[model samples]
Structure formats: structure tokens, C-alpha cells
Target: MIWSSSRPQLGFKRVAVVLLVAPIVALAPLDPVQAQQIPSSSVNAAELISSLKETTLQSGLTVAATTVRTVETTTNLNLRSSPSSSSKKLAVMPKGTELSVSATHAGWSQVRYGGKTGWASNDYLRTVAKAIRAGELGKTTAELKLRQNANTVSKVLTTVPKAGIFTVKRISGGFAQIIRRGKTGWVQSKYLSTVAQKPGREIYIDQKYTSNRAGLTDIYWTRVSGGDLRESVNGKILIGDIPRNSVVYRDLKLEKTAGSVSGWIFVHTQGMTGWMKTSQMSRKSTATTKPSKYTAKQVLAQTNGKVPEKMLAAIAWDPEKTLIASPALKDLNRLNAAFKKKFGKNIDIDLAYRTRATQDAYWIKLGPYVAARPGTSNHGWGTAIDMPETYDYSFRGKYFKWLKANSKNYNWVHRKILEEESPYAEAWHFDYVGR
Candidate 1:
């Protein structure tokens, strides 16, 4: 400390300066806002495009804004350099003009205009929203069958194969809720078509009706009474009191002959009386009537000369009017002859040749009639006859009974009788179907 130099030392001065600068040094923290403001070098073109694609896929926003890639026009149109007409026209883009995109300059885009690739206005060309791909739309398929349970062994709702198409309303997990043939049901989404959805209206089957006690009545019936059958009311046939809607099959005809009311047997459901219309009845497509495969000579031989020529002529003219064929008529003639031989007289015919319309009307009046019932009736076959009281008094009593018992031999069968549960007690009713 006491040492001193006569001359100034430059090296010592530089050393003093370095020592002072070293003491002033210290570390300071950076400002958060300033750091955030700095530009990042990480973002690039590929990253932006990838992010946009991923977002679109996840959000299900498949729609996009689209520009006209090509403008096809029938006539020559002006392509303005600007979006407005006041702007200069780049050129006249005639029909079949093709333009390549130069750039999307502003609200007005720049596309190759006229012959050159200079900027043409975008104001004229309309913009349209993009549509979803065909693969993305819902598809529909027809239902082959309806199962009561998930198991394949479940009960079937329909016997015949019914047709129905299903619309894929929604899809979730592995199951899809679809409107199958108008009914909503669940099906595997994989079963549906992956292509475009079908578009059309659906069709359905008609409703069915069932049988009843007071006679046939569909869901449409509101009232029914015993007096509905005119013949039964006139014949005074006492059809046992039947509860409404109770199903009854007609088996025999109950009629009053000569003031004697009795039941006469027919085919299936023998001694069956009356018919009921039910909600189970369904509409049939067609009904056909054919003549019996017997010749006139065979018919005459079978009847043993009992049937009248006039009746035969009538039947021949309209075989369908009565479900009787020549063979059936032949049998009825034989039965009629036998009855004549036993009872000593020809039986009278009450009603004959009832058109389908008339039969349907009668049923409707009676408040319900089932079409297909067991046992064949003469009225149904058409070769039969109904002996209503309005026809003749001889049609009632023992004559009618004797005829009923021996009529089958001659091929005659009683049509609608109270015993058959038929609304009408046709004492003289007879059919020609051979037993």
C-alpha cells in the first residue's frame, strides 16, 4: 500500500477498469407478456391443413364452401376484372369457356378469363354449398320376417311372406332403430346399405276381422239382431239367444214347413246353426264359380227324371249363380225323385240364383256374415233352393223333414236352416252337391 511509482502505469489502469465492470453484472427475469408476443417458428402449412381435416372429420361438418371450378354458359358473357360492372372487362368468356384459377384476390376472385390467365371477376358465377357424399346417406331394406322374440324359434306374426321396407332412422353402437315396413324395430346397422338411401312411400296389408255369435260382424259392426235374417224372421225359427260378438258356425237350416219348425242338417258342422262375423275376416283377392263336370244326360240320369227342364236351363245359363254343377244337379234330381217316391210329391223350391251381391247384401243386413265357413250350403253352391214361407205353405212340416232325410240320395242338400245356425230358416232350401 505504501509503494508509489514515479511514472503512470497503463496496464494497471486497464486492470482497474476490468475490476469495476465485473462488480456491476447481475441476472434479471424475463417479462411474460413480451415473451408471448414473440413470433413462433413452429407453425407451418402442413400442420394447418392437417388440423383442419381432423376437425372436420370429428365434428361431422362435411359441408364446405365451394367455388365454381368451371363456368359453363350458353351465351357470351362479360368477365369483369372487378366484382362490380364498373370495373374493366378482362375479356368476353364465350360458351365452352374454360378458366383456370389464378388466385382468390379479394371478394372478387382471380380466374383465367377469356383467352389469357388474367384475373376475371367472380360476381357472375354463383357459389353453392357442398353436399354430403353418397356413402354418408341412410339406406333402407325390406323385412323378411317378424320375430316375436330375439330367438329365431319365436312365433311368427304372419304365415305368408309379407313385403315391407325399412328406413335407417338412426345408428348407435351395433344396433340401428329403423322404421321397418311402417313398424319401428331394431336391426343391426351393418345390415343396411352403405350407399345412397332409397326414397319412396310404403305399402301395407289390410286389417283382418273375426267371428261372432249374433252373426258375422267386423270391427265395423255396432248393432245386430235376430230379425236381421228375413227368412228366419218369417219362418219363426227360434234361434237360441246368442250373446253379441259370439262366433257361431252355420251347420243346418231350421225352417217351418206346414207350420212345423224343425232343424235340417247339411254338411260340416252338421246341426250347426248360424254364422258370426268377426274382426278376423280378411279381404280376398278373387272368387270364382265353375260348373259341375257332369253332362246334361248324366244329370238327368242322376236325378231320375225329377228336376224340371226349365230349372236346368236356368242353371246352364248362369252356373256361377248357384254353385251347382251338372253332376250336382243330377244328384239333386235323384234326391228329388226319391223324396217324390217316398212323400208322393215334388218338393218346392223357395229361393234360387242369388247373386253374390244379393248374398253380401243379406249378410250386411243381418249385421255380419263370414264368407268361408265349414260345411257346404246349397245357397253357397248355388244349386240349392230356400223354401221361405213366402214361397208356399206346403214347404213347411213333415214334407220338408222327409225331404231333408231322403234328399241326399237324390243329391239334394238343405241350404240355410236354423239348425245350421243360418240366420234364415229356409225350409225349402236345397243344394245339388252330391254327398
Candidate 2:
């Protein structure tokens, strides 16, 4: 949700209620025994002691300024006895119910309603401004058009109900951009009041991932024979190398698709600050370094040289009578040459560098489990080759053995991971690591 990052915690004390409809009536004098409790040396000794205690309590306690806010949850939010879901629920606050927050916790807010106090989930609380001047508050005088733009000709996004309090941010001619519902929008300035307003409480936005333990702990360094650091999850940009035996932080802020848990994460090493793939990191901090010469640029150079300028691809071709096509030009050609030396026939292809449109079609047809989203697949990058869908049975015996033994020389490697671990798990699937 779009919101401020965090709201400062506030505290408020219970306030006594009083009515002013009747004339003042003095109370009877205290009982003789009650008055006798005071020391003879100090006529107001009891009162003085009570006053000192109250002063100490007030000094030690923090009082939050009175501010109003509203509930923005689609459904009513439960008000609990404590700041946790397990706490006994005291009430339910409905959507648009304006209330005053007395305090705030990590994900909960304490509020008093209907003469009772309870904690509510801060996830649904949207701060509202009261009347004030300067960075002050204003109330809508009438139903005013909240436009998408500053001008009256702009589309009316919604209507601000009469007497609705808003935090005015800026004024452009007749329209004002106000903060409401944890978001900023435009409203008419004439319909808002500049009367003195109560102090507004701060409310923070939730930007963290759903995973609770995300980014909390660091994965210890182990023998690092990891992978490449990418600019983003499944992105092509290579920022730095995540050496073996280094600290790697695992967090949920990175994108996590169903097939891959490895997402781009923040890494600070060798004075560089960029993101890297999580697969390249381990929990162990020390191990013998075995650097692989394989690099993405090497493959890019070969593919780019084969394709036209401004193109990030190579022509996908079918080597044999097989219906499958492959985008890895040099590697595919080498594999076919080696195959001819062993089985005297070409290896068939099942798929290759699919266009964005084609990939989207597969994503729609096969779903996320069976297909990678468009632009994120290695096939689209021209680095992966899928053998015939039935290559497991088609390339049997001698052909299979030769491929297993010789494919590595051409930089092809089969991945062994759970279907949930990677996008797909096909025995015929091979990626060109490097020569």
C-alpha cells in the first residue's frame, strides 16, 4: 500500500468526561477523621504529597496530542485487547470510522472508543488532519470535486464529502492537493477551512514483504562457488561477483516467483553497491576459491556478432528433421557436430528463443509453473535450449551417454532442482554456462 514509511509512536492518558449543563454545586467538607490524616506541620500535607506524585507520573509519561484519523479497510477491522491478533477482540472498527489514536506499535495502534480502550491493526488506519493554519488542517465545506489534475477541466476522480477533514499540501489556483486515505489527491481549495486544527498523528506505510523473517538475519559465509549478481530478479544486468565465503543477506524485498526463490538482493562488497542473485551466495564464510571463467559477456559477444546490430538475439534454427528449434548458434552447432560423430543423426529441438508475445502465450497457456514470464526466461536471452519435449525417450542409450559426456565441453549443463526450486525440471533442459 502507498503510505508513509513509519509513524512515530505516541502515548495518551485517559481523560475524564464532564458535562456543563448544570450550575456549579460545592461539595460537602471532608470528614473529621479524613482531615485528621494530614500532618499538623503542613495543613495541606496530604494534598502536597498527592500533587508531587501526580507531577512525577505526568513527567515520566508521554502524552500524545489529540489527532483524528479514519479506518480505510475494505471490511471492518477488529479492535483487540492487546497489540496482537491473538489478543481478545474488544470491538470492530468499520470503514471510514474516524477515531483518535493514542499510541502505536509495530503493526498495531491503541485507540479509545465508546468509553473503552483497545488496540487496532495499524494496517487499516489512515491519518486525518484537523483544522489548523500553516502546515495546518482544513475541513471540506461541501461536497467538492477531487480532480485528477489541478484544473477544473480535469477528470473528477472522486468527491470529498462535506465537513471531511483533509491535510492541504499545495494550492494551484483554485485546486489543492491534499493528503487523504494514505494517498495524495487534488481537491478544491475554496471548499476547505483554515481554522486552527488539532495536532495530527503520524502513520507509516507497510513496505516490507509478507514474509516475517525476511531481511532479519544474515546467511553466514560458506565455501562460495555461487552464481552471478544480477541487477534485478531475473534481470540481465551483471553488477558484481558474489565470491565464495562471504556474508549474504536474505530478504523478501526482492521478487520471488513460484519457480525460483533466488531473487536480486542488496550486496556491498569491494566498494560496490548493487544487487546479486541469491543463488550465488552460501551460509559458509570460508572455502577454497574455484573461479569459473564463464561470463555472460562472452556469450553476449558471440550472440550479438551473429545477430544484427541493435538486436539481442541469434537466429533460431532446426538442425535436423526434428521440429524443435534452438537459439544457441555456436553451442547448438557444436553439439550437433559431436552428435553426428556418435549417432550419425542430429538432436531434435523442442523450443528456443521465444518472442515476448510467444512467451506471454505460453505463460497464459501453461501458467507460471510450466512457463517463465515473458522477458525473464533464459531462452529469451538465447542462453538456454530445451531438447525435444520427449527427448528423454527419443535420445536413448548411446546418444544420451555421448551428450552427457560431451555437452559440458560446449558449456551445456543440466540443472537438477525441484520443480518448485526452478521454473521447469526437464531432463532434456540444458543451459550454456560457457566454453
Candidate 3:
């Protein structure tokens, strides 16, 4: 009972229904709106990913060229064959999609994505910056207003205090959009400083902080009468005073680990050399020609290798910031000064203090023979120091010979058990024998 179009029994009403559908399929005009127009769509996280297998667009917006770098598409954007709005579409690149930008023109960028090359709206392309596992960590240089949008005229959400640390979600133009304390907003990028934050380790980042590495050339001064520069361990062997208005320089290595956890700094002052309280030190000079009242600050004393971190100091001049017992650090400075004089370079330290947790990790990864037993090694006490396992530090190396002969004067000794003739010989191992 199928009806044919040429059948004489065909009704006028059925023919009229067919005529109505023909115009929509055959005569409808192509889509007229171009997608490249700016400020058209607000940011939408829901549309973050697009995977449109594209049919060639007959026409769309014209993209001239630009952004010769890796950028992310901020929204669902059309990838057109040419730069014009009427150009053919090559693909529908999803939001959050990365594109290799080649050239841009008239608010359009030539981009490559998903094995297809086409033009996309420059409005959706955002420049990329360095990324970290925790995202880009940054600190505000000054108290700033967090704006709802990237522009200064946008609504202010909150006032970010100076030195506030936050996660930078993305950077747009001169502004960086960040999330802090559960609120997200955009702020001037110029007032933001990127920081390298370590996981599982406490990093001391003050306003004076720069990065993970500070240079020895950095200046320091005494802010108070402070403590006597004896050692972090056994406060009895006083070397000198870090009196108020004294100038000093970091001892030994040229580069120091920035934001190190230790509260003691190994410093060398004219005619005085020892460990000082980092809390009483200032990176800025407070000394002036004008006389002012000075007050003495009491130094808190701690005992031996079992002391807390406040009693331990890092050789901040070293990039590794070798940690040691405060007393050992005082002796280390003396040894380093002499070694530097002879070799024109500071001694290289490879290993230093270790938390019990770290010791356990080493014991497992390196084996019992290679690594010190967990919780048993004097490294946990911060009294033991290990030299770099390099040719210069080897038993027969001149640096080793010079150190073996001279280090005793500084109360540091290479034990006989670690000698070349011993079964567990380690020319790099040295113990601090000072009280």
C-alpha cells in the first residue's frame, strides 16, 4: 500500500506538506553570525573542553596572524580556514585547548590544534607562563584590590594584603588572576612576584625573600646586641659578639638556599666569626651616624646536636644550605675560610643534617651499607658533614690532603675508621669534635 509521487490518488494536502519542508532544506541561508567578535561570552568553566570533528566551514571570520607561542583557548572557538568572519571552519577547538599560535591579524590568530590548522579568535587566546606542581605560586608585592575582571575598573572583590601568597590561575595582559583564601580575582601582575614553594618542607619566606637561592653577595647586619657568636651548640665557647650596628657577610659558599628552615645563620664579621640568631639579623642596615639608645638582646642557649632547628644553622652561602649543629657551623666557617684561602674556592659539602624520616628514605633507597641506618646516623644530630664525592675530595686529591692536615685546627677531624685503609673508608666523611 506504499504511495508513489506520480500516483493519481495523491492528495493536495499531502503535496502541500512536502512543499513546506523543501524550502527549509534547500533554500535556507548559511549561518550569518561570526564567532570571533570580542567580549561576547564571559568565562565559563563548564565549556573547558571541546572535541568537535569538524566539517570544513564554508566561511567565517578572517584571522590575520599572531601570538607565536603556546596559548590556551579561553572559550569554545571556531577554527576557520581564513582570517575573515565568513571563512570556512577547520575545527571547533574546545576551551582550555592549547594552540601553537603562528600569526595574528585583525583580532584573529592562526593556530594549530588537534592536527588541524586554522584561525581562532584572539579574544580567547591567553598567554601561558611557567607552571609548577602546585600551580604558579606568587606573592603580592603590595596590598592590592582583587578585581572581578582583569581590568582596574572591574568590581573589587577583596583587598589582598602585601606579601600575601596565592595560587596564580592564569595571566591575562598586565593582570594575573589568582585564588587566595577561597576568593578568586585579578590583580596587577607587576605587583606580583613568583615564588618557588617546596612541598613537605617549611620555607621561611619573608617580605625580603627573593627566590629559593640567595647570593652570598647579599648583605646582612646586626639588628640588636643579640647573642654572642659562639655556636648553636654549647653556648660556653663564645667567639665574638654580634653587637648592634655591626656589618657582616655570609660565610663560605657564594649561593645560599633561599627561605631555608634553619633559624641560625653562619656569618663572618671583621674579627668575629660564628653562628648568630637569624631573628636578630637584618638584610637592611640600621646603623646611622646619629647616636641612638641600644639595648642588649639575650641569646637563647641550646644543647649539643639534639638541639631544635632554632639552635641549628645552615651555611646559607651554600646553594644546598648545608645544615649543621650550631657549634659545628662555627667550626665549619673557620675551616672554610682557610680552605678558600688555599684553593680560591670554598669546600663543597654534599650532605648534612637529616630528619629521621629522610634517613629512613635513604636507608631504603641506598641500602644499609650505602646509607646510614635510620635514626642512628649522627646526621640526625646535625654534627656530621659529608663532602662532595668528587675527584677533588677523594683521598688522593690535593684538596683532601690539604683539608686532612688543616681541618684539625678548626675542631673538625677525619676519623681513622674512614681512612683509605679501613673497610668502610669514606674520604668525604668528617666529624666535628668540638664541644
Candidate 4:
């Protein structure tokens, strides 16, 4: 169901109506106080189901038979009311103490303890329940190996040692489902104590966009300009007056003859919808990328190979142009490779190599060119790339935020933004200082 911000009370009323209208199956009675406390009216089950089916195969569904699933002391562990620590804390579960699994909500699995049923943050859980197997080893799958050490490597399928015994839940591909501690993930099927067969279905949401905030009704029912809502396969269209990153759930009707069933769609910021064939949405969590195939030497050589002359010329004559350098064809190549490694794509270099004559002219026309200023500009060398702010200006955009988080690993620094008395907050400027 879609939630509207305007009558929050009305939203509650609708939920109540849906609950009353929905057939009351023989499911466990949920704690109403716990359900009412969280504001998740925006979530749509249709969309969530669609998202889930696309990524992973469906598994059997069952309600929690117990109040909470406790992680007793193997060590001193934190116990929070919600799955996130940002929520409230009830108490820390001492060694050998029991904790209750209150509810499975969002990414967190809620637990109850100490006369309170709050959330225990899921971050500390070392294992995940669902994971696909990678390859077969003996009777079991091989232990899963991570490309890098990160939290994202949670549910990988891999081979386990033969002597190690694990409680097998199921088998998918070459992996075995096993519970390690209290968490579940894929292990080698050969290492499992036993295997069980289960039937399941996968579901996912058909979102219209990649960004969460576009094409949703929570902010408004119609476009601000009061026009009929029209969607296009190519042209950019503004959704209703929704926030920039809001996500929406839409139900689609498909042709039965075509073997297509109607489902929900998720909208992103770019006015595009992400379509899903399945019925469940997985929580957003970090996942590690495969290590780059390119060696560091190869990356450096490619970066130093060529600079886009036209891009540099565009920024050369700018009124605020401070310093400019002749494009180092090789350095530009290395920069591109480095960026792609970190961001999974090429770095957009607004300014490449510039001629000294053009630099001088700009300096004379304006004041001291940023590059000509003493002891300041990395542009003096050929290792800098200036990103354009707009199509025409030298400002930054969403891409800049990505650079800030990752550029350092590649020896790139955003010189202008780091300056205390910089002329402008130019987010697109980057310089490669050798690591």
C-alpha cells in the first residue's frame, strides 16, 4: 500500500482497513505495540516480493515459533531493541543468557530480552541465512572466499574442510545451507552433517527507477504543474513533488497470454523505474566487487597515456581559470583507470591538458591563474584533472560525493575543495599525487 505524508492519521486508518479486510489466516498473532511503533507505512509488499524473486531463489516461509532468537554469550555482545544500534538498548546479553527473536523486520531480526522486546542490531551477526553455492568439493561445497575482507562477503558460497561438521539446512548449486553460531550462510555441502530438501519461491519488485525517491505518491498525488501523468521510455519527466530519493511501489498488470504477471515497480531519481519479475526485495547492504584484473603498473601506464585536449580547452578561457597545464597524455590514462577501478567506471575529467600560452592569456585576462599562483597548483604538473561543475561550469555533482569517498585510495586528492580559502567550492577538481 502507498503511504501519503499529508494525513499520517489517515495512513493509519487505511492500514487498519487493510488489516481488517485481509483474510485472517492462521498466522501467529503479532505484537500490535511493536508493529505500531515503527513507521514503515511506505513499504509495499507487492514491490518487495518482486525484488526478492529476481536475486535469489525462493525458500519456504515460516513464522517464528519463539518470541525471539537469542545469541547467548560466546562473548560479551550488545543487545539493542531494534536491528540497528541507533535504536534503543534494553540490555547486553550476558554469557549463557537467552534472547528472544521478537520479529523479523527490515534487515534486522528483532529479539526480546530483559523484560523488553527491542531490536538487537544485526551488524554484529557474523553469518547470513541465505547464500548461493559456488562449486562442489567432494560431497560438500568449497569454503567461500571473499575478494576482500568486508561485511559484504557475508553470504558467499564456498567449500568447507571435510572434518568440519555443520547443520545443513538445504543445498543450492554447489553450496550447503548451514547455521554458524546463530547466523546462516552457504558452506561446503560435503562438510554438512545432513541435507534437507525444501521447496521455495523467489519474488522481486519491478521498480521504475534506480533511485528510491522518484515516482512515489507519498509526497503528492499529482505533478505540481497539474498535468496528466505520462511516462516515457526515453524522455525525462518529473514525477510528482516527491523528495529527491524517495522510493515508490507500483503494481503492474501484464498480459496472461505473454506469460507475464502484473507486479510492483520501484522508482529511482533519474525518472526511471526498476522492474522486477519476482516478489521480494532484499535489504540494501554493501557487497564487495571482484578485484581488478589490471595490475598497478598497467593502470599507471594507461593513465599517463592520453589527455582529452578539447575538454581542457573548454575550461582554459574561464574567468576564474587560475592555473593550467599541458595535457600529459599518459597521466590522463592512468587517472581514468584508477577511477574505474574504484567507482566501477571512468572518471569524468572536465579539464585535461592545457597549453602554456592559453594559461598565460587567461592569467593576463583574469588575475593570477590558479595554476600560476605560488606553491599551490598541482596543475603545474600533468597529474591533475578538473571536473566541470555544470555542463558549462566547474562545480561538482553527485559524482563528486563518490570521488570523495574513494579517490584517496588511488592517490587522487580534491585540491580545491580542501583549500581553506579557496575561491569556490569546486567539487570536480582532482590531482594525482604519487602514493
TM-scores for every candidate against the unseen true structure: 0.24, 0.27, 0.32, 0.23
Cα lDDT tens digits, model 1, 93-130, are: 54334444444443334555434444333433433212
Per-candidate count of clashing residue pairs (backbone under 3 Å): 52, 15, 22, 93
How far residue 96's Cα lies from its native spot in candidate 1, in Å, is 99
Model 2 residue-pair collision total: 15
**Residue-wise C-alpha lDDT for candidate 3, range 1-435, written one tens digit per residue:** 000111122211212223333433333121222245333454322222211111233234344333346677666566777655556866565555666678765556677755677777665678664332123446677999999999999999989888665556678887888765556888888777655431111112242322222334545766675345543433543333333544555654421432223776666542224466677777755433221121101111332223354445667445445556655776788899999999999888755655554454445433543466666666666677777554577676788889899999998889897666342456777877776
Task: Put the candidates in TM-score order, highest first.
Answer: 3, 2, 1, 4
Worst 10 residues of 1 by lDDT: 196-205
Candidate 2 regions with alpha-carbon error over 4 angstroms: 1-328, 391-398, 418-423
Best by lDDT: 3
The 10-residue segment of model 3 with minimum total lDDT is: 1-10
lDDT of 2 by residue, 69-98 (tens): 433332345566765554576655444556
Candidate 3 positional error at 119, Å:
57
* Residue 265 alpha-carbon offset, candidate 4, angstroms: 52
Give the alpha carbon lDDT tens digit for every residue of 197-265 in model 4.
110000112511122222233221111111211133223332222211111234332222223434423
Candidate with more favorable, higher lDDT: 3 or 4: 3
